[model samples]
Every structure is written in structure tokens, then in C-alpha cells.
Target: MFVYLWVLFGLFALHEDIVLRQHGIRFVFHGFALVNALVLAKVMLVAEDLKLGHRFQARPLIYQIVLEAFILATLFIAVHILEHTIGGLIAGETLAASVPSIGGGGMQGLFCVALILFVALIPFFGFRHISRELGPGRIKAMLFGRRESAAQAKPPV
Candidate 1:
């Protein structure tokens, strides 16, 4: 999860850099991405420990994965809003002014962000579910094990 969040946040930082560079603003926030990744990763662990989205566990894996992703995305959006609001308040802005526009600006932007986060979380949850079903270390071994030689490889039908 840390690695996933780091890569995602890093890409966002790069996007921000490119967008800001167009306006002659040299802004690089890779450190912010790193910090954000760490914080979010920790939060995710806590959320998991608390079983934030385990209601659909008895159902299909897809249902559980999607439900968990949606829940986590919503939690992340709330965290982002709270962070911005607190920052603004610290800067002496009024309560109303402190609540910055999430995503890009409006409701559509917020939904877009949530959607992106939800999509991003699917793979993480999918892997976790698969790993749990497969038992410990199975996935790691399967992923990193040596490939079969051409002679041993099965031919395409």
C-alpha cells in the first residue's frame, strides 16, 4: 500500500509540476507526495485493523473489493478536505473560507477524484484478497519464482 500510494502521489506531483510550470511557477512537491504517502499508508493500516469495509466479505470477491475501495476513497477524500481546512484555518482564514474546493474545484471534480482513488484502490484490495485466499507468501513466491525454460514451457494450442 505504501508503494502504491507513493507511486500515485508521485505521479500527481509530476502533473502538478507540469501544470504550474505553464504559469511560470516553479513548484516541486515530491516531498509532499512522500509524506502524504506515508500518512495515508498508516491510515490505511489503521482502517484495515478496524475492518472499515468488511461487510461484503461473505459475498463475491469483486463486491468486497469494490466496496472496500469505495469506502477507502471516501475516507481519503474526507482526510484531504480536513487537511486543507485545517491548513487554511491555521493561516487565519474564516471557517467558510478555510474549506477549500476539493479535487479541481466543484462537485464534479470531487467525484472525479473519488473515482480515481476508487479505481486505484481496486488492485490493492484485489491482491490482498487473493493473498489471503492463497495463504501467506504464496503470491510473493509465484510472482518472483523462476520462469520455465522454453523446452518446459507449454505450447499454445
Candidate 2:
């Protein structure tokens, strides 16, 4: 699960930079890293808060939940890139021809499929978590920030 998360993170990073073009967003990397880190940190803090272990400060649920949505949005952008890239490569015979064959069914096909699944699942869980706890408005605010700027900078959705 940890390994998969890391892979998803890398794909998310690539997708954000290459596909989503979210360069205007501040602390993109920090936002991405904090989501998973804070979740685990929160669990530890909550455990410690109950005197289950050593001292650790629990972040407010609101903060953690907000960051999760931002991370999910970033991950969604990245997954969009990965999906189209794979689709293009597989659909184009000349492009697929360039992929070096391994043995049997070939590693490239398996690799591309695995990437798509990994990218797709991260956002699904992230969205469910955010929606269940924080509400869409909270998530939207975190992703796009305050209403004034969000309205001013709205991307053509």
C-alpha cells in the first residue's frame, strides 16, 4: 500500500506539472506531501492524545481534510495526463511499436495498465474521504482558495 501510494504521488506530481499546468498554485509540492503525511500524523497524534503513546500534536480535522482535497485535485490532473498518454500510445500502432518487447505479454502493456489503475484509485478514495467529512465547498475552497481569487482565476471548466 505504501509503495502504491508513492507511485501515485509521483504520477500525481508529473500530471500536475505536465498535464494540469497548475504552476500558479502555491506550495503544490507541500500540499501534496502534507496530505498523506498529515493523515498518518493525525492518526499518531490522536493515538497519543489519548495517552496511547509518545507526545504528538494532532492537526485540526479541517486542515487535514482540506489538504486531502487539494492533493486529490492535483492527483486527478496527473491521472488525466497518464490516461491520455497511455491511450495514445496503445491506440497508435507506430507508437506502440516503439515500446520494447519483453517476454510473453510484454511489460509495457502491464506497466501502462497498472499506472492507469493506480492513478484512478487515489482520487476515488480521496474524493470519498473529503466528501464524507469536509463537504465539497470546503474541498473547493482548499483547492482554489478564497472566493474572490477563485472567481477571478477560474479556469474554464
After superposition, which runs of candidate 2 have C-alpha atoms over 4 Å from their true positions? 1-57, 93-157
Point out where model 1 deviates above 4 Å. Answer: 22-24, 150-157
The alpha-carbon lDDT assigned to residue 123 of candidate 1 equals 92
**Clash tally for model 1:** 0
Identify the candidate with maximal TM-score: 1
The stretch of ten residues in a row with the least summed lDDT in candidate 1 is 27-36
In TM-score terms, candidate 1 sits at: 0.88
Provide the TM-score for each candidate, comma-separated.
0.88, 0.26
Candidate 1, 1-157: lDDT as tens digits: 8889999989988988999999999968689888889888988999999998898888888898899999899988888789889999999999899887867789899898999899989999999999998999999888998789889999999
Counting clashing residue pairs in each candidate, in order, gives 0, 1
Highest-lDDT candidate: 1
Residue 139's lDDT in candidate 1: 94
Q: What are the per-residue Cα lDDT tens digits for candidate 2 across 35-135?
A: 55444335434533654311222654444444443444444334444555676687874555534342124566445644555445556445645555786
